[model samples]
Target: MAAPDRPAGGGRMLTGVTWAVLLLGLWLWGRDITDGSGGPAPTTGDVAAVGRPIGVRLPPAHAPLRAAVPERVEIPSVGISAPVVPRGLDRGGGIEPPSFDTPQTVGWYDGGTKPGAAGAALLVGHVDTETRPAVFYPLSAAHPGEQVRVVRSDGSVAEFTIDDVQVFTREHFDAQKAYGPRKDGRAELRLITCGGTYDRATREYTANVVVSAYLTGGSGAAA
Candidate 1:
């Protein structure tokens, strides 16, 4: 996503001002931090820790084995239908390229953390195409109480009810709020993507849109 900014030709300085406001908003929200260990390195002890809300102590980095990619993700309100694949960070910690051959994909922060064992499962997608529309194109328009479903390889489906949506500047990516401990400590999911306006010069989006929801029910297995 392009960072928010004024159009190159000028005339929309207000857009730049909005970006400034967003920056301030991010500072207030606190920045996200990547845990050095990607997913929960599950151990036998870690398996017992599962089912708790976010913030439970995760297993060591080498604990749990890597899970398979999700089969499908369905969001009725925004019309998002995509397969989930395991996405990890490149050497630089930026989003690695999507595995096109995968049926559906969701990224795991190989350097920062994993999902399902504990904490919030962080999933992200492109809101639109650089030149053509893509999945999550209607993300900014999603409302609270919407439904998001993820079917894992185990033939179990996890359903989540949208709690709220928030937009934050790239500089202010609040990891804790977006992927950190929650009040209820129940299993939760955080879907993220670029939003706001496009910045042609920066070639990045000005803001990130985060959709938060909690798991309702399913086969009770981790995806």
Candidate 2:
């Protein structure tokens, strides 16, 4: 089904200070990425359980694979399988998502850590389009323990095991928690999309849904 009309600018950007904060966080995240950084544990602040589901057993992280361009992403449980395109920062220093014309596509931050690398790899998609549900519209429904696979250009698949699902309101958005590495020595992934209640007045979603996962098991070899 279709959603309400979006602003002429686009679907994801927030307003004024909130937008600035997101941009700053993203910029710092890009600059701070390293093979292994003793970062904080990944958790959603609003959830009492702190992003972990009750008693779900997650797998241990696999050693990080070499850097390679991502070709596609697949989340079988949610029926998401889409082409991934590399994107860079916009003039305002914010990671630019795919153009609205390609709502079925996912955008990867080209300047940041690549999927299967030592740091968290960032992927973003649209929740919906002007005419229908987009690639990651059902992303919030994904649960911990599910798998997110990123097929890389090196002919290997980087398999990430979901450990957390979080929804951060603009006021409570913690970019580091959302974008940083969950564990210091493993490959991680961050899936993000617009979510929560839609604000007609602002023409935006009130929050962003972030899914955190780390490298689990995969087949093939990295180049």
Candidate 3:
């Protein structure tokens, strides 16, 4: 979640999306955060969007409004199969990704919208580890039309289709665009990681890879 250099202690009020990549580092093999350059991203505590509930999913067809929890994420196209965990902002206000020891898994921003629910849900992982490429190394190559599946708690998989694959540089990062919904009413997902070149001097990557997707249709059976 750190910025370009992601230096600790800058007291800058980065938009919600901006802070996510703003501080998640300390030798990230593949960090997730493009940059923090745009306007404010409405944030209400853990909820990334303002006025959202404790959890907002695209309303269940016949099930209760409260959806199941996310257990794991699978992207067959890129062969990313990893457990999902919850992440939150650190003392510095940057998103806190899972530790380097858990490189095999990804972290979901629990404070934000839950995956498959309404609003934009965020999932972040290391593109690489200190020793090698981590779970999200192939993120940059992700294209539109790919299928992203999220296995949830209530016995269902929330499937989303890729809409856009982009790389946001430190100078051009926008929190709202990165973490907001594509339309006024829809469920969206954001897969993020550090991309481009790594700056040894700054200890952070110059660009961040952001993969955007939206809930289309999914199977009834929950995994």
- In terms of lDDT, the best-performing candidate is 2
Residue lDDT tens for model 1, 1-223? 2223444432221124433443333233222433232011112310111122344333222122134335667888766788666655445334453442331344433333233334456666554333334455556566566777777776667776666666655554554554554644366667765565566665555566667766665553553
lDDT of 3 by residue, 1-223 (tens): 2232223432222223333553433112122222311111222222222122333344322212235568899998878898998777667555677777777788887766777776667888776654556777766666677779898877788888777766665555566656666674577788887664555455556556678888876665542
lDDT, candidate 1, at 158 = 70
lDDT of each: 0.49, 0.75, 0.61
Model 3 misplaced regions, further than 4 Å: 1-66, 200-203, 221-223
Candidate 1 vs candidate 2, TM-score winner: 2
Task: Rank by lDDT, highest first.
Answer: 2, 3, 1
Off by over 4 Å in 2: 1-24, 34-52
| Runs in model 1 lying further than 4 Å from the true structure | 1-69, 97-117, 219-223
Better of 1 and 3 by TM-score: 3
- The TM-scores, one per candidate, come to 0.62, 0.83, 0.70
* Prediction RMSDs, each to the true structure: 12.3, 5.4, 11.5
Q: Write down the lDDT that model 1 would get.
A: 0.49
For model 1, where is the 10-residue window of minimal lDDT? Answer: 38-47
Model 3 weakest lDDT span, ten residues long:
36-45
lDDT of candidate 2 over 101-139, digit per residue (tens): 888899999888899988888998877655567788878
The number of clashing residue pairs in each candidate reads 29, 0, 23
